[model samples]
Target: MTRNATSFPFDIVLFDLDGTLVDSNRDLAPAVNHALSLEDRPPVPEAEVRNLIGGGAFAMLERALQATGGPVAQTRFAELGAELLAHYRAHIADNTVPFEGVTAALDRLAQLGCKLAVCTNKAEEPARDLLAKLDLAGRFDAIYGGDTLGPGNAKPDPAMLYAAIADCGGGRAAMVGDSTYDVRAARNANIPAITFRYGYHDVPVEELGGDAMIDHWNELLPTLEGVLTS
Candidate 1:
């Protein structure tokens, strides 16, 4: 087989799992709400959960508390976080679907010889399972889970981003994700990052400081084409 670097401007197109590829947050919101309810807290809205996402479980939980103006307690939060993860695991694949044009976009990238991978703050089991369910499993050469290696492998840190680069064979690579966490990870890893306009982020897309900002998944194709062919 030919090397991925030859034909694609980026050898690998690494994605952020939650908002970028799949709507896993629908399942996540309910689990979080259930956890909150268990703690006698008010139910959280999905919009709140959407905004709280992208930083993995710990970051998400901390942000969720801040969003609701609830004092964050680490010990209590850990227990509640476990409950949320349990609930989330039970319904992980339910209601999860690939974003519009994702398959087609990936198809074009593959046809153009771009290797694909996933770097998600999601847990490995569910992240890997969701991709398999969406038939996007084989599409990626690797999946970097938040808990896969250890505590700090999650997004906004760049560890997983660097890992993905290594997994894709260590040449030209690009990170494509929807959140500021994703963009930050890419920038920290010293890889070019591209942000999707429509994905969740605490900061504005432009403020995330990605190499490029794209509003649609289909744009990935032409953008990548320009990268390699330029």
Candidate 2:
């Protein structure tokens, strides 16, 4: 994509994977339930499973287990997490899809000369796989996942955002996500954050503390312009 004559305020725009770019609960909930079934736990309704997302696979599994019954032993938890990932990978895009207006919005950003990158808490391989399967991978300059920077470097930790900005040839940037991890990471990195109100946030969208909140993809560019310019 060619840059327009008028420069976009932010050089790079980083996005979160699960809830920000796509509504992945259809496949994610089932994967969580699949792991729960191993412990004979009842399935969490897909709607409820939406609330369990955002942190990462293991964190999602932990929330699912806690909601169904209680926590499991670490070893068992690891095993269940493996099961969840296995099931998810096999059916990754079975029902997963981007939110309304996502493609158009991305195209608009590209036209505006904004380099896009995904800064997600999902593992690097699956994050790439999901985007590639959806044909959205090529739009991004980079994809940084929870495992991308090694242990203890996921969002709410700023490292991934910093890395993504640098990898995309650093300049002023903003994070667009659906959860606290995204907002907090942007704050930690001293950048602006624009959050989606319809994402998988556990708390009220107002409580997310993003620089700006958007209810739909159509609002993204204007919101980003507002946030960056104001």
Best by TM-score: 2
- Candidate 1: segments with Cα more than 4 A from true spot: 5-7, 227-230
What lDDT tens digits, residue by residue, belong to model 1 across residues 14-132? 89988898877778888878877777778778876877786777677767666666755688888988988888888887877888899998888777777788998888987888788
Backbone clashes under 3 angstroms, per model? 1, 0
The segments of candidate 2 whose C-alpha lies over 4 angstroms from its true place after superposition are 1-5
Checking candidate 2 for backbone clashes, the offending pairs are none
Highest lDDT model number: 2
Candidate 1 TM-score, C-alpha based? 0.90
All candidates: CA RMSD in angstroms?
A: 2.3, 2.0
